[model samples]
Target: MDEHSTAAESINPKHQALIDRLSTRRSATTTSSDTARPVADFLSSFASSKLSIEQSLSESRSRADLDHISSLDLDQSSFDSASSSLLPRKKFSFRNKPQKKEEDPKNVAEISVEPSAIDKISSLSVRDGPGFRNEKDTTLVKDFRQCDVGQGEFTLSDLENCRVYLKGTVRALFFYRIRNCQVFTGPVLGSVLIEDVSDSLFVLASHQIRIHHAKATDFFLRVRSRPIIEDSNRVRFAPYRLTYEGIEDELKESGLGEETGNWANVDDFKWLRAVQSPNWSLIPEEEWLEIADISQCK
Candidate 1:
């Protein structure tokens, strides 16, 4: 009984020391500081006891136990292979910037066509001519009473009035000053002057006209019996013939106008517009690159 008690005391001390050594080794090797120390200590004690059992075992028993343990270790390795699928994924690598693609030159050109367009039928009259009162200051109804009105020589006013019809083209786009006439300030009438046949945008009678190279049409100007009121109290109407003389001076002078904005150089193709509006409303998708014929309509 004494021998057995002493042997147990000695085994207890050795077991405790083995537990302490394994616990220290596990702590040094593993990063899992959050794991329970009691659980690790229990596992270490279990491992030591199993090793002691194997060392003290009979040769036959040891062989059998070792075979069994080897089979269990193989089974554990197989389980690890299965459970490996549950492991955390590695970080992924991705490209930061995308590559630029090459564009076909023809496609680029078609996409960049100008939006504004010029209208045809450049000339139209706001009012029929040949009124007796050519100028307000030059004529007086009271003065006509004492003078011979029938003996007057032929004048430009008379010739202007005698024309039964006038035909011309729009040379430019302009705005008429509404205050001067009963008509409101609006789209310029007689925009392109048909003095002869000229293709250009110019200013006329102090009005600015921007000439834009455009596919043309021959839609006649439809004048309203009543005046049109637009954003301003201006009458909006189309006209025939836009005169270019004033626009030439403006282009040569400051080389700028309301239509061109900051684009002053005449030679710059980027400065070119068929008309002054910023919208591409009239252009068809297919005909963006092609010019419209000025002489006829499609």
Candidate 2:
């Protein structure tokens, strides 16, 4: 045999059989158009299937994204509708109307009695309390010396041309619509509220003092905090000059024993400028009264 035949004979039968089968298939594919057609058909079918699967996955992802965006838009719209339902909308109108001329300050002053009118309205609603109220052209006196500690709030309201005296410690004091009166009181532990008081003199000690709508009033105050006034005119302040038996003890107990020198510290809310407020002034020493002896006042 020749060398090629001898090598083929030395190969294993199984491997030799596989080699021969492959060589026959290759030859058939090259020679016959029918056999090549089937291979081409298979490759084309596999490529088309892969493309269809990729397109389906991309379309599904796009649909999911669109659904998610729509859901978010729906949720935002729902929230906006709910909030709008809870709050009423305010409407603004714009019109070119003639501007009104400013009124004279003097004319405004002539109409300034509105505060007294308002005070009348409030006086109509005033209820009787622990202290004197609605007394006209009278003198009233109350001795709180034997009362309990932290004796409840006291009120002197709607009194005109009266002399009022309160002795000993009280929790709070309220004076309203008092006209042409002299009011003397012992130490107030809490606060003193005065409103619509005109042409009056007050000698009191308190933790806080607030005067409102008062005209031509004088305050002799020993207050822990700076005294404040609003809408008040021609008010004057001086050191507290009120004296009665046991007043020192009452002052000490109410934490006002020392002269804190806060009496002259007046703040007028209506006058916020750097200049001295026209609403209040410090009473000259000569004009200051001597310590009022309220022990005998009744």
Quick one: best lDDT, which candidate? 2
lDDT of 2 by residue, 1-298 (tens): 6533333343334333533543454455645565555444544553464355434434444556434433433233553454334323335666877789999998898888556656563654544568788888888888887665347888888899999989888999988789999999999999998878899999989999999889898999999999999988999999999898888988998999999999988989988799999778999999998988888765
**In model 1, how large is the Cα lDDT of residue 29?**
44
Candidate 1's C-alpha runs over 4 A off are: 1-22, 26-62, 70-298
Work out the TM-score per prediction.
0.21, 0.59
- CA lDDT of each candidate? 0.29, 0.76
Tens digits of per-residue lDDT for model 1, 1-298: 4533444454456555645754665555455544444446556556775566435432224446545443433233453453233222244766675668789888888768634322122232223322232332221111111234221211112111111111122223222111111111112232322211121121122133232222121111212121112111111113322222233343233222233221121121232456632311222334322221222110
Assess candidate 2 and give its lDDT. 0.76
RMSD of 2: 23.9
* lDDT (Cα, 0-100) at 205 in candidate 2: 97
